[model samples]
Target: MLTNAVPTTNGPVVGVEQGAVRAFKGVPFAIARRFAKPVAPAAWTEPRHCTDYGAYAPQPGHLDLAIEESCLSLNVWAPAADHPLPVLFFIHGGAFVTGGGADYDGSFLAAHGPAVIVTINYRLGPLGFLQLHRHGFGEANNLAMSDALAGLDWVRANIANFGGDPDAITLSGQSAGASMVIALATLPQARGKFIRALALSAPGRNIMSADHADDVARRVLEELDLAGDAGAITSVPLPTLFAAVERVSRRLADETEAGTLFGPVLDGTVIPHEPREVFADGSLCDIPLWLGSCRDEMAMFLKSMPPAAMIRTTERQVRAAFGEAGWERLLSCYRATARVDEDPYEALLSDAFWHRPMSDLARVHATAGGAVWLSRFDHRPALEPFLSQGPTHGADNACLWAHLPNFIDRPILKRMGGPMTPEDIDVAARFQANVLRFVTAGVPDIAEAWPRFEPAKEPLAIFSQPFHVIPLNDGARFRAWAELTARPGAVA
Candidate 1:
């Protein structure tokens, strides 16, 4: 069912699909940004062939990116229109700097359930972020968020022909992508525009202080060979700026233990408040959620470090990075909780970054009476650099892509030169099956009525060799982090 031109509410649309499994690319969901301004819908003259994706929105250094005007486009894959289906919108993560939606082929996830799968590319790094760009007469402060808003609005206005129920869209993302969901959901301008459910994997803090935005802008400017004080950087060649920002981001990611730093900022227009504050105040979209991090989140952070060093990292190190009382508190939790001292530093990395932030989000969401499902990935990928990568950030993608649990010695994927690995395929099927049921019915699969957080206790369903439950928030290890990093602020 490929058509060269189909009439849409916004404009005349022409799209093509390769096959039953993969179709719908280069669909224009919004007007293109021209000369620093997002224009109104421009009528099409020719039957715009949308079968192939349009030029990727300008990104820092992605190999496929072609800088062009027609970047506000999205690609979709869904069940044939013979039936109505839930919709899944994917946001790619690249530390808010790199990645294009075109990279993630959605045919795999489309098979998970009866839903339209959408993969997108949005403005990244200097182009999309840079709230401080508005200072001293910059074009826009929330460019990245504005682009995302346009994409979501497009989904809301026109997902029906693709056999997708726009009302049942579930927004999901990983890494920087995950953080984008958090920011958009918190932005009042985005309320009810698109998405009925939220799924964030390894989300970062979005609402930044003015100081934070200034620092980020300075960094970007400095990399452009201009004064970091924000002068003449924007005047530099766009491609040069993009390339320099990309290099500086890589260097900054290595400069700190915290990894990358590009993220959403509170610019008063698109972002009126901090996301953590929005979560605390219960203003976020009230919907079913699936949220959690991996067991060895720090594994990826320690990948370059000697495994021998990782195994022997001491409390002295943790304290130095954090503080004295904090280190001791976290150490107590690690030894008492995981029940394995195989790697002393494991707890250090877990508490400071993954465990604390993840649990805090879960607790706030659950406490707000939102239906939040918690999960912890304990599966270990130990085949190729598996131990170092562990079941880190994109572990869930294994389930989403190859349809397998975290592979131990096996690649978590079996016979992938074919369809998804049996295990991952099963997970992809079941994951969306339940979520679809929840989106349509308002109850996240009655049979899967997961547990809720109880005060200091955090419960997460484990998707591993055998499905089991693991107490996360209340676990001694997480509690140690809660104590160590506990602040009056909710940004954690």
Candidate 2:
């Protein structure tokens, strides 16, 4: 019996049914050309078999894997074609360079609920985000985001066939994917694609101006030694072009300390304005928002720094960036909150980069009379014995999705392998429930009510071993950093 057969807006797709859930994989929503805007896929009359995941965007390390230009596809998981369910539209994150929607499994989430989940794959790295249209490339600015828009359009047009309510869509993502959600929330083009958004660990500061984007593109050309011939950037061998992207990215990171080498740029057409400015002005669509960061968002990166350098150079750099007065306040705050001497640097960075920026965004949104609930994911991983610290960047992902990321190395898993403790199990269940509830009902379904964020009450959902809510714990030092960032030329 071909029970999984479903009709999409453009074609008939045959998926696989297992128990209550049916999944369709590698369904092309758009056809993409290298460094160009994605176009609608050609319609098909025959049933297209969508049983396996499709090829993902090209990245640096996966050279041996078969990469392709037509990689704009989406995977869907639903209960049945007859029931209308809430839709969770998810975007995957890999620092804006790598990652496929397949890395995150939505079957568990969809099977346990009255909801349908869709995960999309967009262009990454130079192929996706590099703004090369100035040199005759076609709409190269924010190509990754453009691909996301196209996928959202497809969902709006065809999710009904997958048992999803097109009007009750929740856009959700983490890390770089969270950044895209924030971008869509601010951009005029994405006003009604999703009714609400759940942005986890949104790096609201990644969006750069058009001039900076063009500068990066120019440096990429220079790195490839094609400075005089900009058009050659598109014609170079794929491997060589990827190598040049790596070199240019590493150079940018070394010199400027940027998190992502290529991402959503403030091109006048695609992204109208700097994202921070847009969020601050309360220009985002009036959608309920659930967003926050990990308690130790920077510790994952800090683990790689030499212990001595982290102790000595990190604070010194902080002082150099801020002033003497600012440094003193930051030190006081760090000392007040630090668990150990080595923790001060990590705390400073965590607040400055992730926590503070998001807090500011919440403040602006709440002031604009939007419904917002903020939280901090404090649950540490039960795995990974090599690290001495608790829940760092990407740590909450395992708990949030109830599955480990595809990139988790087998050796690391083996050495630190352990069953989820009772505490871990409880937290994961509650966290997943709250997320599903928020997507379905516009509020969390935890044991206690998740309060709306206000300046005085400052409610937050702290997801620890026994998940609970609390008043804002970030102290005056965090507020100082937020104020400093609001000033021009301070941080972005």
Candidate 3:
């Protein structure tokens, strides 16, 4: 069945109804040019049929979605309910380069959560993260972040029409999107927009310094042969512009500390200070958080590398960031914890990039009087090809969205661990329940079994076959990483 026309700030929209869930896709939230701030879309009187997804931001071809600048749209899935329901607004992750909200299907979560689910699309790659205002291109620093804010603003004003409580919204994301959630928490403009946050597999570092971002912009200009005339960027062909982005990314990967050219810039105005610092000082402690990463976050990347090469590359990087002595101590600590079939280097990269940073942030946030919950997805699915890699990156998403009809057919999940098993269903039910609990109740679990994260105890919910909560053993390995992070040039 199809849903009746629903009124929005911009206009009325008609959507599709699947069972008890009504899906409104391709709802334009805002509109923007190549390098300008997003503004609300023009008002329309006639009801628009939004049965299909809108175009996604331009990027290197990965998904088969249409690409265009007018990609600032969102999708909504509202379940049948008599009263208002909490909303889960999610941002998709692709390293700030590739991906769109349409990649995720919110039907399962909407019907099961009995909550309104909103997924959004934002600018990407050079179109999103390239800092060009300094070079007189336009007011383009953190434009994608601005786009996210605009989406939230639209939701705050229009969600109630669809039976969602405007006051209770949970901002959530995964990977690069998770980093944006953390960044949004520190922005004064985004302070009261969202009530809680859920960050999954957020990188240790995603913000780029102003100087580095400027350098990247310069390199991109040079690649496009527009270094002398930066204003010409507005007219460059899309394919040519993305090609330049790829070249600049490859050239600067080894030079930049964060190992990527595009990300949210530490612009003095938009993002005043480091997010971790803000969380450490208790300035944003009022908002609760639920954050975690998978056990083998780096396994997906390192699966193809020979063990010897993987160890050698990891050793060099670790030694450069941390001194030889620091590397030796870390090696000893990880060796003590490594499984018989596990590669210590893989574990080291995973912890350095994802696990340790999340753990540190949780500790600091808890120390600063914030209500927080820490978790780690440790269930390794029974699928093969890379089964020995254990619970790898994107595994959490696989379990979280397993109820979607096409979960087994999604290419990424298929590559990770797919063909959904009975065990996967069991894990997905548990994972989705915890998330829904937080969205509706503000706390994940009230029972003593899932106590709030505290710095003194460092408790973590381990999401495995038989889920359990235990105090994390922050032993020698953690200390070694902490010491390294304290050093001036350490990326973590």
Residue-level lDDT tens digits of model 1 in 1-492: 555455566566665554555467877665544224344457666666667766766664443446555677788876565777777787877667666666666665575465688877677667676655544635557677777777877777778866788777777777777778877777776777554554545643444565556666677766765663455654566678777766765665545433344577776766788776777776653766666566666665566543312222333345565566566666665555554434446646665555556666777876776667667766643333434566665565544544233332221112122333555545445555555555455544453445655445566767665556766645455455555555443222
- Per-residue C-alpha lDDT of model 3 across residues 7-52, encoded as one tens digit per residue: 9999999999967899999899999888999998899989999888
Candidate order by decreasing lDDT? 3, 2, 1
What tens digits encode model 2's per-residue C-alpha lDDT throughout 95-187?
A: 787788877668878876668999999988888888888867757889999999999999999998888999999999888999998887777
TM-score of 2: 0.89
C-alpha lDDT of candidate 1 relative to the true structure = 0.61
RMSD in angstroms, all models? 5.1, 3.7, 3.0
- Sorted on TM-score, highest at the top, how do the candidates line up? 3, 2, 1
> Which ten residues in a row are the worst by lDDT in model 2?
404-413
User: Could you give me the TM-score of model 1 versus the true structure?
Assistant: 0.81
- Number of clashing pairs, model 1? 9
TM-score of each: 0.81, 0.89, 0.92
Query: Distance (Å) between predicted and true CA of 360, model 1?
Result: 1.1
